[model samples]
Target: MIRDKSFYKFFVILVISLAFQNLLVYGVNLADNLMLGAYSEKALSGSALCNQIQFLLQMLVVGAGEGAVVLGSQYWGKKDLKPIPHIIGVTLRFGVGIAAILFVIVFVAPTQVLGILTNDQIVIAEGVKYLRIICFTYIIFTTTNILTASLRAVGIVAIGYLVSAATLCINICLNTCLIFGNFGFPELGIEGAAYATLVSRCVELLIVIFYLKYREHQLNLTLKKLLFIDTSYVKDYIRVSLPVLLNQAQWGIAQMIQTAILGHLGAAAIAANSIAVIVFQVISVAAYGAASAAGITVGKTIGENNIEKLHEIVHTLQIIFLGIGIISGTLIFLVSSPILEVYHISAEAKVLAKQFMCVLAVTTVGTAYQMACDNGIIRGGGDTSFSMKMNLISMWGIIVPLSAIAAFVIKTPPVVVFALLKSDQIYKILPVVIHLRKWNWVKKVTRAEI
Candidate 1:
């Protein structure tokens, strides 16, 4: 059943779809940085801090989506249509609830939320404005992503890519027009960026709805069915998905602390770190895409009862990912100077950014292996709970304490502190490599649905 050409076809399509989606999503981020950075450094730092909450919430939704994929891919592989609705229903239920809670918290207590991330009054005030306006976008974002993740589960990756690209283009155009009053547009500045995001999210939701109606014929999803509470599937989804949600949420929290540390370091540090992060994320699109594709492919293989091919597929992917890790790391290093040149940041910030970029480029080599295998191959084999534990252990246990010390106690340079903060990637490599040899990860998750 696992033909080389056919698998490659699936691999390439999903990789492109997911990679392009990352490019578009992060490209909008780059635009935000450009527009906001040009507007004011304090504003840029403010928005960056506010977006941390967004990142935290997105991780929760993505965790739910990952649950959908884990179940949906297996069902799709088994050619069973019955369980798809239940899995999606559970995912949507969680996504909607999280989005609503996030919206209320950000909208009602904007300053309170912003205050937690940064100590600067200017950044807090600016971030409050962005948070209040951007809160409205969370619901649509969460729901749309759940739907798209389910689609990706069934090998329908293009729609998400197209939808994201279209929305990002709109977001950037609106950002340009509104942020600077270009083409006779009002110069809303910070408010303008928030409005652009709000408008783009609205369009993104509508486009996703349209795609589901016209293109997702096989899923045959209805508003009633998606909203219908399947207690059984909800339980099952939680049983498997909670760890992932916690893994991401906890990881997000720890990462937030790292952000807070950087935020406190100075506005220059925030801007420099922000630029470096955006660039690294762009380069990382390929690895992330491959990870998702591998998950889907391995999940399908497991459901179809192709154990031998499953092993073969994973082993091959490991080698390929390691190679990608090396090349991507090298590539980021080679181009760092040019990339930094394009940014309008100060000489000081650029100097800091280049140093951090060096650490990122080097760490990406380890990242490729750890992320691809951890999120992809192992979890696809129905071992998410273990994956979750691994993350918690690595991040909270090791990354957090060391980062605190690096930033607080050692009082080292920003780049060295950053390198210490990112040491988790290096630390995780050994554990992941060891775990891959074990047989416990290959459990079949597609028993008859309740």
Candidate 2:
């Protein structure tokens, strides 16, 4: 639908950079999974459980950042730079608050928290070891994410990937030295993985700080701007960002519940689910990236008041989303066996992991399209409430209840439960399509005078 070569050029470059950055981020997790799987299944399972807590923090932090982008991009489109620093400031406040609260909860009751996920005492012990060390990174990760998100809104995305690349390399090297006790380092096992991640997060934060202080010229963001924000934007921010925050919180809790259901099944299900999830995340980075790109594009377009071209732009993006979905799903199917061979898990775990990946492969087609359509286009256009409503109805009202019953009452196989848990990805397409046709998602979230 789009005949403009420039649009394609910009979209391709942005999506690739965002996707590669996301890939590097998940690559850190892949490294941890691979190293710990080789060490022991208990260690792998523990770290994965602990990572769920981390994932919840990430969802909150990302929600705050996405809120900033939803507002900041429109300002950027209008070439209004003054409001952005304030938006970042507001976002950072929420990010730090969420991180601090999570750190406290985890630190106080590590075992109690992990216990909710699984019944294995050995897994709980290992998870405690990892959680103790990794909890320190929560605030650090949140700060880095918010800062980088501010940069991303204004089209400075390359630095994010660069920082992730540094984090990935550092994480791998440290993991190699600590996990196996190579090069005179202590063999901390799961603890070593946690330490590696902590160090990498510190390094990532440092890099972003240096870039914002020196290289970034757009906003010239400094401590003063970050600390001294315009309080007037708080109401505006809360109005637009609350739904996104709640949506993320809802989704994060749902994921933990899903994990709990499978965890109660057995250790094998937990380990297999972990492996399958990491692979799916690694493979679907491009799809997620496309969503991020869509958010920025849609938000900026709305900000510019370029309503006439919106339909063409969105249509083109949908086509691209479908293409990315097909390719990513096929790749997941093809690479499942070879990737499974790298893990040193049991035969039962490997088989379940493969089946889980196949289900993800099919659902990914829906995910790529619907995620971009809803999270990217709709939410990005300032209808954050719509996503909250959609997720509430689809995930909580339908998927979670059904999946819980299947896992608990029906006592279905793990694969069937997993498929049910993911079916929302497919069925969500109908509502998203219907919603897109109505054209009510377009709204200018920016202010007339800031």
Candidate 2 lDDT by residue in tens digits, 1-450? 999999889888989999999999999999999999999888999999999998898888888898899999999999898889999999999999999999999999999999999998988999999999999999999999999987889999989999999999999999999999999999999999999999999999999999989899999999999999899889989988999999999989889989988898888899999998999999999999999999999988888889888889999999999999999999999999999888888899899999999999999999999999998999888899888899999888899899989998999999999999999999999999999999998988899764
Give the per-residue lDDT of model 1 (tens digit) for 365-392: 8898898999999888788877678877
Model 2 — TM-score against the truth? 0.99
Candidate 1 — which residues are off by over 4 angstroms?
1-3
Against the reference, the lDDT scores of all candidates come to 0.84, 0.93
How much is 274 displaced in model 1, in angstroms? Answer: 0.6
Q: How far is 195's C-alpha from truth in model 1 (Å)?
A: 0.7
Predicted model with the maximum lDDT = 2
The numbered model that scores best in TM-score is 2
Worst 10 residues of 2 by lDDT: 441-450
lDDT measured at residue 76 in model 1 versus the true structure, 0 to 100: 84
Error of 2 at 4 (Å): 0.3
